[model samples]
Target: MVVLTLAFVSTTLDLTLSDHARKERGWALSWSVVRSWRALTAGTPRPRPSAPDLRTFDGLRVFCMMAVILEHVCWLASLSYVADARYSELTRRDYDAMLMTNSTLVVQIFFLMASFLLAHKILQQRRKNLPLMKTFFETILNRIVRISPSNFVVVWFVATWMERLGDGPLWKPLVGGEAAVCRRKWWTHLIYMNNVIYPDDKCLIQTWYLAADMQLYVVALLATLLLRGRRAAVPLLAGLFIFVTGINFTLACLWRLVPTFVLHRPESVLVAYGGEPSFNVLYQSPLGNASASLAGLLLAHLHHALGDAGVRIADHKVFRAVSVLCAPAALGWAALSPRLLGGGVPHPMAAAALAALERPVFVLLVTVALLGAINGVKSWWRTWLSHFGSVAPRLSFGALLLHLSLNKALLATRLQPIQLDRPHVFFQWFGVGVLSYSAAIPLALLVEFPTQRLYKEVTELINKYKQPTQDIKMDT
Candidate 1:
């Protein structure tokens, strides 16, 4: 009713008021929104952001993005035990082939990429001498706007509409928990607290990431403020990184926690093993994931410092060898991590320490490897990877938001889950990706892209107004 009333009033004022009066009453803001909507939907569309593009970075994003989708597809398929009798067969077939379900590890890459790009951008802004307060809010709020509009629409649908659209042996189980949680605590997600409160009853299941990343972004920006224009920034950042590592070490050692996806196991596990096994404690907290983002930030700082100093790792054979080896080493480490820790309790004390250090270790390996890839290193492997990665950065977020629900919707409509096979899984992944990307294109264009432009224009307007006011005050 409030929304309707606001819509009515805005339309009425637009129809009834003069331009000057509308401007005076701040009705123009509403009309500007109207115009933005029209322009986004019908006008010349804005171009993709043209910041210095690193094919390797974007390309890596594309790879990780697809990996995330594939991971979830495999996961949700495994869960069709809720509907299909052959579920164990399905799981055995996939597990029979060694498909691990702990795909949540891809999120660490995302955290790193997000902070890496953000650090680079904010460093540019600092070079331009952007104000600290404005920079902080603009950085944080821009991220919110980027994710929230589509998130709100999706959450609303999940809560109010998703279950009603389908009914089956599978539909209730697949959608029920998520729908119930969103109905109760969607606001927590809106403000990045989803992981902290009743995390077992997670709404979208995937959104724990957004929450952790948002919390980390706030930390990153505050740290950025401290580092701005400081000669001692690197040392200070290193000190902060050590402090964060210490905190994570303390948490792991205190609880002897293992990192596992909350969803991969039966919901019963969440109840049976409450404290350390609880998703909220080990997997979902900002502290649990802080190393990846901070590592990315540190890498971004190093990249910037190197660029300013005219250093090129690409031409150096030793650096190139290290970069070449880093890729397989990271991949091997991740692939072997499960066996190293073995996905259960009673890990060796060494394994516990490895679990704590694994995150930062993975961060180092990836950042170093990708830095070489993105830095024009002229490697054939990078060239091959970059081909797929170039568009990943833009499309990845949209795909992430769309894929989980798309997977649910697809499964809910299935009369019976198919028996698992390599061929079947491949086809399922390909088809779902096709549909998800198709839906994501318009969502990105109509909703995500335009809101970003409108936001940028608004901030530019604020800066414009502030400059004139500053001039007036100075003259006075």
Candidate 2:
């Protein structure tokens, strides 16, 4: 409930500011304010050459990361005092309600949006003599370097702590045993393939999404390469989406037939595939995520095509109104659909309706919102949202890594007992959330920033060496 409330508030603020900015100021001034508000809020000047528009995507990325963090924190807190069975039925009911409401599908919207924006930038850069392979390889390498170091640090901490605290053999089916597991399959994590085999047993529980994202990245890069020309891009992307969706649908059917074959067992089938164990086929399969990634690719292509026309569709009042309406409508359907039908008996029509209201519809709504945001939604609320969006990339990825890890640490510590029934629980959670953010700020400054810089430096050094050798060969 806290998480939802916060999300609602933040979103409302964003919209309100956007509308105000649009009404009060011209597009140029509104855009300027939106882009530069972070600097103003931070008490600094907007830097020269301006921050990259990719930064806007990063802002959204940070928001998603924060949402995931909150969801996990809420889950951890609910299960914290599970050993105490003395709680009332109402307490248990509340706990279940909180858990249900903490779902992270909302985060997936930002993920898809980021994919779209990033793919757009990648395609744009490709036109300027950039080798597609080099870009693709570099992207993979950067993700590895950026994500793995902190991840491994957390894994090491968790493994050591759990072993000491449990004081017994730690179950490690994937790695054969506790001691040998880290050494053997750690490389799998480094390469982001851990989800294929070790879906249930993760090093850092959230890293599954990292692996999924990496897989999506590879597929997107390939698609971008195959459909580089203007005329071929849309048709190719549409074909790819259909192909991937068909594969996902087929896998979903298979998983329904043989339930255990899916990764993460039954739950994976439902969440990933869409409910029945048969859905597991589609659920565990990376193709669905790849389809969303492709959707993002298409969005990028659309942006470029529209950009060439020098017209901003987002600026149109009708488009903005439609995009704004989609989000609430999707949410309303999601909230009421289950209850209206009564629980249990799952008909095909009901299942299909639920699936329609899930991630894909949410993704479309998010895409519309983003388009409106970018195309000149002038308002103070938008200015504020755009500001947070600007700061998002700088701290978001690191925050995502640290916040959940901190929550785990807190759980492991077994802090002072607090009554969840009390209103103060919200304040306590907020304090913890703030502390997590505070810790993440420095980690972002020290670890994430330095690591990214080092990766860039290494790439530059390699390129320098390769360039001279290439020049020498050409002279000969």
TM-score of each: 0.81, 0.71
Q: Mind giving the per-residue lDDT tens digits that candidate 2 earns over 266-368?
A: 2342232234333223333355466667668877876676776677676688887876666456445334434533444455544444332344555665666
Shift in Å, residue 265, candidate 2: 14
Report every candidate's CA lDDT.
0.68, 0.53
Query: Which prediction has the highest TM-score against the true structure?
Result: 1
Clashes of each: 2, 18
Question: What is the Å distance of residue 159 in model 2 from its true position?
Answer: 2.7
Error of 2 at 247 (Å): 4.4
Q: Which runs in model 1 stand beyond 4 Å of their true positions?
A: 1-53, 82-102, 261-278, 341-351, 389-392, 460-476
What alpha-carbon RMSD in Å does predicted model 1 have with respect to the real structure?
A: 5.5
